[model samples]
Target: MSSEDFPAAVPIPVLATQPVVLASGSQTRLSLLRGAGLEVVAHRPGVDEEEVKLSCKAGGLTVEETAEALAELKASRVAAKVPAAYVIGADQMLECEGRWFDKPEDRAGAAEQLRALSGRTHRLVTTAVLFHNNSRVWHQTDQAKLTMRTLSDDFIERYLDAAGDAVLTSVGGYQLEALGAQLFTRVAGDHFTILGLPLLPLLGFLRVRGVLPS
Candidate 1:
């Protein structure tokens, strides 16, 4: 959808004057922000995500905390380069039975991840952090609980074949917005959050900060 067709829930007048940057390489997130009528520049923050995730796990951080920390790290890294802009960084985590899942490395790994999640419930925790003037100013986390239907090995194989490399792009081995929708029996959460950005809360924050017309 075009930004004109999907106006911000709370339009901010100042958004026209200030620069906004998205600190990640996710097309999904960039599209989301633009779809909400926010003019934003995309920057790859280049944070070592795996190292950070390992450190957070070793330090006993919960999955939600880890996701938020990663978001802050990405936002902060990009904020330093664009000191005058509002930088948004977001990260998502998939957790099932206390185990956290990362984006699969290959199709085989994606198949394995899906097999493990089959017939089970998992939580998708997505966090968004904002930085302004080189300082962390705001953050929000949203979670979605999804229940996957039981899958036969044959179905898994065919589904993986159909999904191709796309399944590896998400931690949960599925994209609720696409073919992945067939895998879920139930989903409970905001659509944006499930897609890896807590857009409503982030928009609310922007409106409150006068970044959008209040």
Candidate 2:
């Protein structure tokens, strides 16, 4: 979607100094932040995500906590390099029952994940953290509940064929914003959050910090 299609609900003041840096390589997140009228610089924070997740799991952190920790780690890493700029970092996790899901490695893996999620509700835990001067200034976690329709083996095959490698890009093996929408029976949460960034709350926090006009 175009930036004009999702204008910021509140007024945004002109930034006087450094531009906001996005500590992620996600195109969706870059688009979302720019859509909200912020000049964003995309920086891929080279974080060992699997290691962090494993550490968090070993520490008994909840899915939400793990997501936030990952986000903070990315933000802090980027912030250390650009201490003067506002750095935004984000991460997402998928959980069904007590099991956590990771992005699939191949088409077969994606199909397996989809089959496991068939007729079941799963939660997408998305978290964002903002940092400035090498310190975390704001953070938020949002959850989206998605219910996948019961799928036959044939349907899974066809869906995978149509989705191609796109399904492997998301933790849940689906992207609700695209053909992946057809896989779900219901989605209960913010659209931006499902897309991997909690834009509304992030913007609200920016406003409170005077990064945007209140």
Candidate 3:
């Protein structure tokens, strides 16, 4: 986006408060926070994502439950250290039918995901949690449904060649904001939520908590 897009300068909060901490090492999430005018401190809590998901499934948790559980675990893991400081934790899950899909492993995996999702609608369930002083203060989960435009093998190949290894980073091998937009015929939900953070909801929590100027 260009400066012209934000002609009205955003008011930067000038207050002495603990910096907001992000509990995951996601560049996209960091960028989102910065774009929203919040001073953020990102901390990657080294937890096993796969293990958390597996445990949720073993316990027969629903899609939203599973995502929330993962977010809580991530925030709680770091909350133990940052007393009185707010830490944000987020998690996203891709579900097609009854199966959970993860980021593709390689080109072949990307192609496989594209094939499975061709002409089908899938849900991306994202959860965001705020933790303070070892307590769960606020959290939310949003569901986004995207219908893939019928994909052709040739187009998939071209997309893979253009996107390269980046496709391996997101479930369904697509980023809705970039070249991945070409893969979808329709999407229903807030764009930020689809990207993995429900910015408005999270920001609302911060405002209510006096973390950001009300």
TM-score of each: 0.91, 0.90, 0.91
CA lDDT of 52 in candidate 2?
92
TM-score for predicted model 3 compared with the true structure: 0.91
The local lDDT score (0 to 100) that residue 50 gets in candidate 2 is: 92
Q: Show model 1 residue runs off by greater than 4 Å.
A: 1-17
Q: Which is the better candidate, 2 or 3, if ranked by TM-score? A: 3
What shift in Å separates residue 7 of candidate 2 from its native position after superposition? 22
The lDDT of model 3 is 0.89
Q: Candidate 3 — which pairs collide?
A: none
In model 2, the Cα lDDT at residue 56 comes to: 94
**Cα-based lDDT for every prediction:** 0.90, 0.90, 0.89
In candidate 3, what are the lDDT values of residues 1-214, reduced to their tens digit? 8988887966665442447888998889988887787888888889898888898899999989999998888888888888678999999999998989988888999999999999999999999999988889899999999999899999999999998888988888998888999998899998999999999999887888887787
